[model samples]
Target: MSRTTALDPLFTAVDTAAFTDRHLANLAAGTLAAVRVPDFLGNAACRAALSALDRLPTTDYDPGRVPTPIVRFGPALNDYRDQDGHLDAERYWRDAEAARVAWHRAALRPDPIAVSMGHLSAAWGAALAPATINGRAVFGGTLREINAGALIHYDDINREYPTGLFDQEVIAQLAFNVWVAVPPTGGATTVWRHRWEPADDHHRQAYGYRSETVEHCQHVTLTPKLGDGLLFNPANFHAVEPNPDGRRIAFAFFLGLTTTGQLITWS
Candidate 1:
């Protein structure tokens, strides 16, 4: 893997106390690699969210498709995608509603997802709404426990549903994750400066591409910390390093900046 002589200016991570309009704009415009907010949730809030996790029903992703054992407590749209890359709306909606009910029953105080969204909306200076299909709002926010790590991959709703998925025209998509618990070591996420291209398919493996896909691209790696929030462009290739120690639990969702300049969310 040959490395670039100097890192690209737009491939830098911005660490701040809170998510600012500038940071969000720069990220969406591909002028920034990522935005990290330390202590996005308070210690007490993190503890509360973590405590509620035990009571929530968690399930592993399909072992056949995902060799890694990722425990999660919400519906991910990709899981409902059919062979033709189309959404299985019926099953997705059912599971999404069930997950919502289970989340409420967990009785997590100061709901971390809602709190995170509130802060994001404040930064955007407008309310962030859930992206809807037709008139029905899609589910937002999921609790994922990734201790074994995830595969190298990129997520773009536009590419996932080429014909279009939501009623709003999403011009850009950002991934948001707030950690309630993190391992003592490892569990770092690495985002490469590369995006998908036709030639990259030769390295495709399982649900993601091989590491060689972005071997020569500039990248940024972020270690997860409790109460930390991260936002990054998901169109860039990224992967998570396995954590051999404690649990890595996070509340996550995707934010889509529509053509109309509204930030909509979905999981």
Candidate 2:
């Protein structure tokens, strides 16, 4: 992974109390903003999706082998990076059949789960009208959750571009997840006012980055309710708190924003 020295301008002058289009500009500078939209995903649709997901098969993704069921998607990713960024394709496509079926089942339904992930990515990109990538989204991510909770980390990926898109065309990627199921306790996402610049290189390793790098930075942790859709730049340092006694499930995907503002996505 590499860091870009050029910093985008942050629009601190704009009012962020509401999540308006203005946040798009702020997002370019790596700012975190959220707005509570009423019925972000129709209540009935959101509930149905959650219920349906519970019945589907899930593959464990935790390195410690916790019972966290996850289905990671994208055009084509190799293998998970080892403890030192080394490639290992051993677990590649282990449960491909089951994952694809589950994804498509919800995608083609009358009241689909937040639309096709690709469609949802495009709709959001079009709404943002990013400078380069316009409505062209890649599809793949995961129904993200953790057994107890996830460790503090940034969701940025450094994968080889076998999907035909080079990294140079994109400036940053955004993350959007619909809150369909949440716990009665902790499951908040905390976005730190920090990006993974080269200075934070020491935190890089397999099993994910450490939280100490941005410990002193300011942060805003969000606990979204059912049907709440959240959009923010995933390039910033962020983390998720634990929900030991409950489940926190979301359809998580990444939105690739090109330097010219085109929108593309993959999980």
Candidate 3:
């Protein structure tokens, strides 16, 4: 008999067909991979979508006033801030629908975001067939640009999650991003295979869990190409490197399964 050592899932590829739903869920729980779906939408569609973002009205800094121009693309999610100077939910969704339509028209194909999300969900369900994946897995999250970089941090470490959230199954969950625009330089996402736990209370603060909290952890970096899609366990420590040459724009979301056999997607 052979034994399998528990290890993090790490994939680097141009296709994801080989991975099963269990694989993806397991990846979310304890794996990492960067898959490049070949011609998934192609660079042309990405360019079109990127250009279209400018046409849509953008909201000013978020509630805490982050000073970033954020567009809540697609339908709004719970707890989404009605930020000052930002487009309200109605306006935002209306524009998002318009943008998605225009981008698909320009792509001369189906809306990649829509199509991608559908495929992803279906695959996940199939991966857990007979379980009847039941839960709200809708789209709509922050779409924004960054000129510089982001400091090292772990996402969702301090989130006061609502009751019955699917991602609660595990202390970890997966994150998704479809890059519509990439800077000429310095736009890599840096991630440390580390996570937040009570052990790091000494350095943990309200603002964030600084990188130094787990200074000795090994790390990895990933840079997205135009039209590229990525998935990772965001609960682990991660950060975005600055892009000095140009702005980096992307659509982001969160994904996970529930202990009750429901796989969900949200932003």
| Candidate 1 lDDT, 74-98, residue by residue in tens | 8988788898989999999999999
The 0-to-1 C-alpha lDDT of every candidate, in the order given, reads: 0.93, 0.55, 0.56
lDDT, ranked from best to worst: 1, 3, 2
Q: Candidate 1 has which clashing residue pairs, if any? A: none
TM-score of 1: 0.97
Q: Which ten residues in a row have the lowest lDDT in candidate 1?
A: 1-10
Ranking by TM-score: 1, 2, 3
lDDT of 2 by residue, 192-226 (tens): 66766777778864534677676666666787677
Cα distance off (Å), candidate 2, residue 138? 5.0
Q: lDDT score, residue 15, model 1?
A: 87
| Native-structure RMSD, model 3 | 7.4
Residue-level lDDT tens digits of model 3 in 1-267: 433334344632225533357656665656554444434556877766766675445554353533333334444343343443222446545555664565445542334556566656666764321111133223344466765666566555224342333333534456777777888888898777677788776775443555567576656677766776777776777777777687687776666555555555555
Q: Name the candidate, 2 or 3, with the larger lDDT value.
A: 3
- Model 2: lDDT to the true structure: 0.55
